[model samples]
Target: MSKEIKEKELIIIGGGPAGLTAAIYATRAKLNMLLLEDQILGGQVRNSYTIENYPGFKKVSGSELADLMQQQAEELGAEIDEFDMVERVDFSGDVKIVETNNYIYKTDTVIISTGATPRKLPIPNEEKFSGKGIHYCAVCDGAMYDGKIIGVVGGGNSALEEALFLTKFASKVYMIRRYDYFKGEKATIEEVMNHPKIEVLFNKDLVNVEGNNFMEKAIIKDSIDGTEEEMPMDAVFGFIGTEPKTDHFKGQIDLTDGKYIKTDESMRTNVKGVFAAGDVREKEFRQITTAVADGTIAALQAEKVIVERKKNQK
Candidate 1:
């Protein structure tokens, strides 16, 4: 006999703020559902130093906010399976098939909230110094550089914000950018430019990193003058935006040119019972508030679909 299949009315394939919000709504609707996460309950949010734009609170640490969201979802009776990675998905049949490393789940509705991951530089030695000197999350690794010099790469909002946060631990923060200008909000840009600890390097790029075993210095080049310099740095943090995590749903789902999932206003995808939400979906904004809104819509639409199906069966 084939392996026994576990069935549910809905399966949410993420554990970020979007997925946790969906779980809260799904439990309130009394829908039989499960939320599967690849590793920890928190997603990229855990890497954030502080969240100020999420409302309710003026400021809160990213880890604290994530813990609160997870606790709320669990208290609502949401069945969450952390550390179960989704290897494949088949949405061809009426019942969506989701195969994880731990189990195979058959569901009438599927919500995709995988979110996005940080983008890395194009240096050959970047991967080699990943854990040694190069890092993606400033909050997770900033303390290691206390009273030391560090470098940050990127020109976007995230890069500028992280550079400012790194100042809490690092004595000096070198803001390296490929262009002379920054593309973040005016307020944030002003703050970064005015910060005493942050040194903005215009029209410059980080070519490579060097050290004995761990990284000790950064090779920076001037794009305009074609000059290079090796700057002593204790660590390097990269925050050059993100890439959508939609490789698994490539053929089965519709995606934008950037590989982000395409969803309607209600968070419903092209497939009948498949939905996409949060930063994984093609949207102009990818803030925590927007992710929560997307999750709410997806969860309500999923409940409606399941209810209509039961009515039709009767």
Candidate 2:
């Protein structure tokens, strides 16, 4: 029911900006490499609308950027296998083994670039109404609610950013924060507070999402007084936070705070020949540019390891 595939010099898990960037660098280094992705090559970027901060592109669609990165990796001789979900990984041996649904791959070095997922709101009918009228990324689904009323949950930078972006489409935006104060950057808070289209509802928490087929209203409760209020809206967006997707690497590599994989300055994990990049790694800023930088550094370090090994063989 399974087959063993030939080993490669390097294998990159995940197909997002980090994984793709690593593949490009490894291919240029003449390291026979393969890239594995569970779904498409774009990763979370595909769920975004526009990316203006990635430098070299003033304004570009997220999907377009992902496609371009994929094309570049392919042109550089990186073999990409989409829809390949890795079941397990073995990094104890000299050759790392990556087991997927279709086949097993061996590699001299492995780079884990698996990213994080958005945190969900705990409320009734939340899962049932997902995509019906509720969303996680405002940039991705805000345009659909144009000229309508929408609610945004959380009080962080992402929440405020989403609220600001929603103003471009929604006639009115309601930001619900559980506490009296926000945890976002002061600048973002000031911008949101000054925005005419945005209204902040402090000391409130979402209790339920009400609708039959699409989101029609949200039930909010005052954290202090426990008073409930129903707000009618076309859609609800949540930007609470994100959790790393590092459960698979448990006990296999060192991690920080049981979330991000711990890596040295060179991006090498505690395990030799094993590296991590992107949001999965412990870093100060988790952004597209930083992810790309991590990938490049990991690939270059892997190349160095390969060169040293070849020399030892002689």
Over the full model, what C-alpha lDDT does candidate 2 score relative to the true structure? Answer: 0.88
Per-model TM-score versus the true fold = 0.95, 0.89
Error of 2 at 228 (Å): 3.1
lDDT of 2 by residue, 1-314 (tens): 55868788898998889999999999999898888999878777776666767899998878899999999999888898989789988888888888998899988899999988888888878889999778998766888998999999998877887898899999999999999999877877999999999999999999998988898999999999999999998898988877888887888889888488999889999999999989889888887899999999999999998898789889
Best candidate, lDDT: 1
By summed lDDT, which 10 consecutive residues of candidate 2 come out lowest? Answer: 43-52
Q: Which is the leading candidate under TM-score? A: 1
lDDT of 1 by residue, 1-314 (tens): 35457999999999999999999999999999999999787788888788888889799888999999999999989999998889999999889999987678999999999999998877889988998999998888889989999999999888988999999998999999989899888989999999999999999999999998999999999999999999999888988778999999999989999999998899999999999989999988888889989999999999999999999999
- RMSD of each predicted structure: 1.6, 2.4
lDDT of 1: 0.92
